[model samples]
Target: MAQHHKKIYPDVEIAMPTRPRASLGLENGDPSPIRWCHQASPSLSLIPSPSQTPIQTLNLNPRRCCCKCLCWTVGLLTLLLFIVGATAGIIYLVFQPKPLNFDMTLSARFNVRITTDNPNKKIGIYYEKGSRLSVWYKDTNLCQGTIPKFYQGRQNKTVLNVALTGRNRYGTTLLNALQEQQQTGRVPLDLNKNVPVSVKLGALKLRKVRILGTCMLIADSLTTNSLISIKASSCHFGLKL
Candidate 1:
């Protein structure tokens, strides 16, 4: 009965669960944990940044540039010369001289005698009429007439006559007619001796004449002395004997 009374006076104590200790934010020898210190600045982020590449420049050679320039200059000069030539030709056509007026005609004849001993020789006459007269004569072997006995032992003589008729420009024909009269016993001519004789009528002074041989004769006897009037645009007379 005494033991029961003592036990009842003393109360029994109860046990409770305890929490784990914090690591003071430290790992190994470092004060801050490796994972906590922002991963050590993310290990300096070894990722490479976008790199800028250098741009290459293009360069022009001086020799090539000069050659191109030279080519252009030559082309321009050629064009200029062509333009000048065309301009000059046009100016020449705009101005030209006028022509003269006159009438024109051409004629020719031959005279000869032959003997037996002095065989009759043939005569060839070549003549053309224009602003001028071109005449060529040559002794030929062919003869039409029989030789005369009186000139048998003597040298044969022959004569040729040519006549040009046209209106007088200034009496220039007078001199030629006189000379013809003396040389060939011909009458005075009314033709323009100074004027060039042309193949086409009325195309005088502008006519040209060329003769290869000296068988040309102007017979004053066959020419007219009277002055004649004629209408024409121009007149030319030329003599090649």
Candidate 2:
């Protein structure tokens, strides 16, 4: 009976989908609002809000200032040392000082030929008073004398004659030794000179300084009655501060 239905048909009503009334700008008196929503894919519907990561900051420690200060201090000290060394070198090169040399020869009996030399090329010597020279024979001072005060110019050599007279207490002892050594042609004698002098610069005069020089002589003969000649000689001198 269901397959062979009659020709009578039943009537049915269906409603279509509508958009929201608020989207169409409709008033409350209009027809009822119908909301229509699109079907969303479950994999792509949700979206997260925009956000930013916090920025990192840096702070300086106190030790950084100490390191910087130390570096600057070392640099300044090095610069000062260089300057002082350069100044001292300059001063040394500008001034040239030298020592004096005394050379003597036996030209007469008791009259001695004395030669004094100023070795300094840029400085002159002003020989002051209280300067003396002596001759010795066998630990006995044979004769002693004084040199006149004079001004010795730069790089100069002067020759003078001096007479020495003294009482010989050990006359026989000296004569016996002279006779014994004269035959062997090896005689020893000592000469010492003490000089006080001042150096003269361009226009300035320096303080007085004592120079003690000694000469050891080996002679062929040295007799009280006869003259002697130098065979070998050695000299040494020093400056007293």
Q: Where does the lowest 10-residue lDDT sum fall in candidate 1?
A: 140-149
Question: Per-residue lDDT tens digits of candidate 2, residues 101-124?
Answer: 654322223566889888888889
lDDT of 1: 0.37
Residue 212 shift from truth in candidate 1, angstroms:
32
Model 1: per-residue Cα lDDT at residue 107: 32
Looking at model 1, residue 239 earns an lDDT score of: 53
Question: Lowest lDDT 10-mer window, candidate 2?
Answer: 101-110
TM-score of each: 0.19, 0.51
lDDT of 2 at 3: 69
Off by over 4 Å in 2: 1-109, 119-121, 223-227
Give the clashing residue pairs of candidate 2, or none: none
Q: Which regions in candidate 1 have their CA more than 4 angstroms from the true location? A: 1-33, 36-58, 96-241
Each prediction's whole-model lDDT (CA): 0.37, 0.78
